[model samples]
Target: MDLKTASSLHRLRLVSAPEAVSFLLLLVCSVLKRTTEFNAVPVMGAIHGVLFVVYVLFWLDAWNRTRWSIGTAALYFLLSVLPLGGFYAERKLKAEAENAVIASRARAESAVKA
Candidate 1:
């Protein structure tokens, strides 16, 4: 694949877990703030907000560079909102990267043979 696609995919993979963790932490903080004296929601909210924005920008870049179908792009976009979605997206991206690597290697082997 093109370098832009690879770069965007790599970035998306990197941010996925961090964003998910931040989301879960923010959720926990929200609950705690409501149920008890604990109140870390503001801090967690800011962290999650930044991560979410980064995730969205990476997602858009990947979509544009990778030329994903609308449906595929929507799925990735939807996954960002769901609490556990980042993990899933990360897994999918990793698998795609692996497959891309394998394909590239196979192409290289064939070129060498030729």
Candidate 2:
């Protein structure tokens, strides 16, 4: 992919895992607050909220730069809400980046030959 697309995806990938983790942590904190003497929901909630927003922003940038189909965009959005989905998205993005690199190389080689 082009540098802008790659950078956007990379930022999204970076935020996604943390956002997922924070979401899980927030769940745990909620349970703790409800069932025990411990309460961390406020702090965890804020962290998760920021990360989630960052994920959305980066996701939008990636979508715009990559020009993904509606289905693809929806899939990414779905992944954001699932706790384990970010990891899968990261793997898929890596593959996409590799494909883009290969395609770029092929184009460069063709241009040289022509």
Candidate 3:
């Protein structure tokens, strides 16, 4: 992958974990709101909403840059909705990006040799 594509993927990966964290926190806050006077749902909800938006935006950018298949794009989107899915998404994206970098480097090296 080129620098732009890689950077897009990096951006998505960066937000993935935080987004997942926010989602989990929001879930916890929901339970707390029901059981006690501690009401953090509004704050947590807003935070999670923002992160979810950012994740979607970054996902779109990455999809545009990488032209990922429909199934792959859907998987990422699904992960965002599921609890703790963002962490898995982040890991997968990291691995994919690393592999892309390695392959790109190898191609460059072979071209140089040729």
Candidate 4:
């Protein structure tokens, strides 16, 4: 992948897990609000909301840069909604970025030899 695409993917990957965590925390806080006096729903909700927006923006950028197919884009979008799915998305994105780096290096090495 090109540098822009790689960077976008990196950004998305970086946000994915944290976004997932925030979502989980928000859910927990919602439960706590109902069951106990400990209420952090507003705070957690805002945090998760910001992260979700950031994730979506980054996702869009990565999708645009990489020219992913409809299925691939849909999969990523779906992952954002499902609980704990961000972790899986992060893992997948990391692997993809690593593979891109490896391929980029191989191409560079071959060009140097030529």
Best by TM-score: 3
Estimate, for each residue in 15-103, the C-alpha lDDT of model 2 and write its tens digit.
87888889899999999999999999999999999988898999999999999999999999899899888888888887888889899
Best by lDDT: 3
Higher-lDDT candidate of 2 and 4:
4
Cα lDDT of model 4 by residue, 1-114, tens digit: 787889999999999999999999998999999999999998999999999999999999999998989999999999999999999999999998999899999999999999
TM of each candidate vs. truth: 0.94, 0.94, 0.99, 0.94
For residue 98, what is the lDDT in candidate 4? 94
Give per-residue lDDT, candidate 4, residue 38: 100
lDDT measured at residue 88 in model 3 versus the true structure, 0 to 100: 100
Worst 10-residue lDDT window, candidate 3: 25-34
The global C-alpha lDDT for each of the candidates, from Candidate 1 onward, is 0.94, 0.89, 0.98, 0.95
lDDT of 1: 0.94
- Order of all candidates by lDDT, from best down to worst? 3, 4, 1, 2
Model 3: per-residue lDDT, tens digit, 1-114?
A: 999999999999999999999999999999999999999999999999999999999999999999999999999999999998999999999999999999999999999999
TM-score of model 3 vs. true structure: 0.99
Output the worst ten-in-a-row residue range by lDDT, candidate 2. Answer: 86-95
Q: What is the C-alpha lDDT profile of model 1 across 1-114, one tens digit per residue?
A: 766788899999999999999999999999999999999999999999999999999999999998899999999999899999999999999999889888888998999999
